[model samples]
Target: MKKQNIYILAIESSCDDTSAAVMCNDTTLSNVVATQKIHEEYGGVVPELASRAHQQNIVPVIHQALTKAKIDKNQLSAIAFTRGPGLMGSLLVGTSFAKSLALGLGIPLIEVNHMQAHILAHFIREEGFDRPDFPFLALTISGGHTQIVLVRNYFDMEILGETLDDAVGEAFDKTAKIIGLPYPGGPLVDKLALKGNPQAYPFPKPKVKGLNFSFSGLKTSILYFIQRETAANPNFIEQNREDICASIQYTIVEILMDKLKKAVKQTGIKRVAIGGGVSANSGIRIALKNTESQLGWTTYIPKFEYCTDNAAMIGIVGYLKFREGKFTDQSVTAKARYIIP
Candidate 1:
């Protein structure tokens, strides 16, 4: 007779999204994501506000994940949660919930790296194609991180390069705000970039020494440029919103692609992938697709749903870790920073 399949329930509330999923090995039966609209009122994610929202939303979110997957709590082999590189309070809610859930179910607990989970998310939905092979280049871009990572194995990863200043998402959000978009405006910026000219305003890419990036300067530059342009011609942005979005998006994408191209060259890996929220951007998608022909590399971009923070990702990561017997003790705790001790 076949063995009883092991299941893992995963939760992610590292930031604004309260997500959960149930995965049996690599096959995700259900992936549930709950986004916080409360944050929309603020110009950005207010840390404390995010935590409260997570607390309110986590229980129902988790239950829905289990129900959607048709997997009962007792059937779960282990529980996983995003434990760090996120807001402390935000991480705490998920961590505490996971710990309590695991304790209640008498199952093992596995703590997942929020960033690493984002990278591992590729394995969740399987993307309906040949999955990315090992020793490939993965760019994890989002609100707090912009990194080029080398994934050699399930848990083996090295940071080839990362942002030195503001993250790509921050750049997008700030740029969007300057252009009169609402908070969390990255998506809006992408939407507006379509009708605009990519060559409208040429923003100079910062001369960062290596693969490390610097988008903070770019954000400030855009602000000043907008201010100056508005002073000279009040209708400059009003008449050319699309152009502004296009130009700004182009500059940011160029910075990211430049480092990615270098990583491909240095690592000598032809397979490249992009993950994280910004990976959902149409511009980034087109840019990465173009790299396939331009740089002679096989490219990967997980399906749009898998790109953002979600439980299926954590479950995928959990699937890998579970096989290795990588269980975290009851004493496991959430971290706010990168280093684990």
Candidate 2:
């Protein structure tokens, strides 16, 4: 008998981005993300505005996803949605929509953990890209999360360590803000760091034991360093923006690499994979590649599109759950603090 193909429509409104994706048997046909630009004025995401944007963008985004995939809603076998580890309001927009859509289409609903989706994103089938095998080490870094996970299997993951304070992305954004950069300035910092001296300004690294990380100290150091320098010379930041960015980026990368080295040594798992928004940083990418050559480790870095929050990652997890018949009932609601189990 020929195998039947499964279609899953996945929704991701975890934070500020409203995304929808269509997947057929593990292949993503289309992934549409409607990012909210309203928070630019505020310098950070406002929870209420993000949810409102998600409400407005969800329907159209989903429509575009299905249209792009050339797949009808009736053909969907299951609807998957990010169920937690996100802002409650944003998660609600996707959760309610997925539930209603699954009910309307008479299909099953699969609940996906946002963090797990980041890890499972590697499993999405794409040519010339190899997925990490089971029991690989996964580093998930983003604005809200910084975690080192021991992925034993698809649904079985152990978080060996995580951020005690600010995530690496948060550190970047906050540092950028300190130096008078615009909102969502993490990527901008990465761009400017390319032309500057990485060791120009030294920021202290946190001495956290084990694999856990603490960036609050680093952020404080940067903040104080800027304040002290600018007090003596008002144009200090203007005089050395690129070098500051490079130095900060360098410190953050070293902090991350130090922990990753410890994780590899302790676990004996040389297959290192990274996910989430911060994984897209050029410095971190280069650092990982260098480790691949120097440490004799196999590294997995997803494409930029997959590095950040996207529905494709959710869709990949959805497809995996569909295969396992892991359906959730309507009682499942949005969770703001869902832990990876």
Compose the digit string of candidate 2's lDDT tens values, residues 269-288.
Answer: 99999999999999999999
Which consecutive 10 residues in model 1 have the weakest lDDT in total?
Answer: 121-130
What would the per-residue lDDT of candidate 1 be over residues 1-341, giving only the tens digit for each residue? 98777799999988888999999888889999988888788889989988999999999999998999998888999999888888999999999999998998899999999889878777764647458889888899999899988899778898878888799999999889998899889999999998889998999899987779999899989999999999999999889999999999999999888888888878899998788999999999899888898878898877777888888888998888888899898787778886321
- Residue pairs with clashing backbones, model 1: none
- Native-to-model Cα distance after best TM-score fit, residue 19 in candidate 2, in Å: 0.3
Q: Residue 33 in candidate 1 has what lDDT?
A: 91
Candidate 2: stretches off by over 4 Å: none
For candidate 2, what is the lDDT? 0.95
Q: In model 1, how large is the Cα lDDT of residue 59?
A: 91
What is the lDDT of every predicted structure here? Answer: 0.88, 0.95
